[model samples]
Target: MQGKAGFWNLSNKLTLFRIGVIPVVALLLLSPGRAPNLVAAALFLVAAITDTLDGYLARRRGTVTPLGKLLDPMADKLLLVTALIFLIPLGRVPTWAVAVIVARELAITTLRGIAASRGVIIAASWLGKVKNLLQLAAANLLILHHPYFSIDPHRLGTYVLYLALFFTVWSGLDYLWRYSRL
Candidate 1:
């Protein structure tokens, strides 16, 4: 049991490492005159994959820890926020979208912190998960420059970003309403 727990812990740490890589990857992709966008996109994709794998492994292996619970969401938010921030000034994404998403994240983080103080674990909701998936899809599309399988990258990216923005606002409000009733 001890050994198994240690392995899961290690996996959790790796997830955090992947999360930390997002900002660097974003900067690399955003740099002017650099065609390294594809490389950066690959890194982002790897990080996103690891995010899914780590959580699934933790649950299947029964290695979920309080630390993992805390760090996992933090990592997700960091990656999303960093990617959106980088994409905004490039005109690939709108400032309003980033602002709304970031605001929602901040509100949820604050609510979670307050709830945790009272020993309440505000579990991730289905809406929240959907919001996350949409956000991830948006980030990936934007980073990939929307050219996957002959898709018009720029237009597709804009559409996805807008969709993600809508979900972000919806989920944020959902959380607020849920919290009020609790």
Candidate 2:
């Protein structure tokens, strides 16, 4: 019933819900208020949960669809990209880092497209998953910028974000190397 499955399916619906949450998160984060940061982090956490749930349900229930596959990654990218971009103004993160992350993502995405057009399958690597987790954790920590329990979240998040950037570039290169083989 894969053909019968569409946007109405649980997996696809979760994907769409995640996508919808992106703008809300951005709006909440960007709003000038004391609570925006915490709110943004909470919304982002929910989105991340949806990302996990959707993928799990898709494979578990045999309801995978091309749309779900595309939307899921897109939602993740948008969430990460939005967070990084928004944080630039807040000075919690550097513009250069965001620029580098964005550039690598663009390059890898383009390479993936080219590889797909040439009938080459370049699946996500373990590094990519780690990069994502690092990015998500960094973003959340940065969002909660203030100190908590004698720990400077901003400083810690910066270090993690830098690591995410390292893996991002590494994974992009790996993907390009894969594409070149095709």
Candidate 3:
């Protein structure tokens, strides 16, 4: 049963807020110019930050809900995947990289569902968390795309993305190796 906070709790609200801002960020990125990209990066960062904030708030306030659990991951995938796809058209990210990232996400998600069906719970791994952080950082940098004040966001983002891809493959294999018995 949900607590008194119910579905409208702050944490869930933040998750919903993250979902709500995704379209706005996408549209901002679609616009051409430094200002739009910068704004999109800022908004994307806010949404990503809320991902952590919402989880922390839910746990700390005892307001974790089934809906929250369901929406949080969905919101994250939508935001990150959308950003990556948008970045491709902007010439900010490579198609093959996005394909690998998407494939890993789908494979892991499918793996978890299969495990769940057999009465097993494959909990999130630390490497998975690190991958999320790396992806978020890369997406923000790649979205920003251009150099600013002696900082080249695209090159740096590409470097971070390589690390993210490494982690993504490692974590996916780790999950499969550990949970294949299920």
Give each model's whole-structure lDDT: 0.78, 0.84, 0.93
Give per-residue lDDT, candidate 3, residue 22.
93
lDDT of 1: 0.78
Candidate 2 at 56: error in angstroms? 1.6
lDDT of 3 by residue, 15-89 (tens): 999999899989998999999999999999999999999988998888999999989999999999999999998
Query: What local lDDT score does residue 18 receive in model 1, on the 0 to 100 scale?
Result: 82
TM-score of 1: 0.87
Return the candidate ranking by TM-score, descending.
3, 2, 1
Q: Against the hidden reference, what TM-scores do the models get?
A: 0.87, 0.92, 0.97
Q: With candidate 1 superimposed using the best TM-score fit, by how many Å does residue 146's alpha carbon deviate from the native?
A: 5.9
lDDT of 1 by residue, 39-141 (tens): 7777887888777888887877778777787788788778878987888777778888888988999998898888888888788888888888888887877
The candidate with the higher lDDT, 1 or 2, is 2
Q: Score candidate 3 by TM-score against the native.
A: 0.97
- Ten residues in a row with the worst lDDT in model 2? 1-10
User: How many steric overlaps does candidate 2 have?
Assistant: 0
Q: Positional deviation of 17 in candidate 3, in angstroms?
A: 0.9
Q: Which window of ten consecutive residues has the lowest lDDT sum in model 3?
A: 1-10
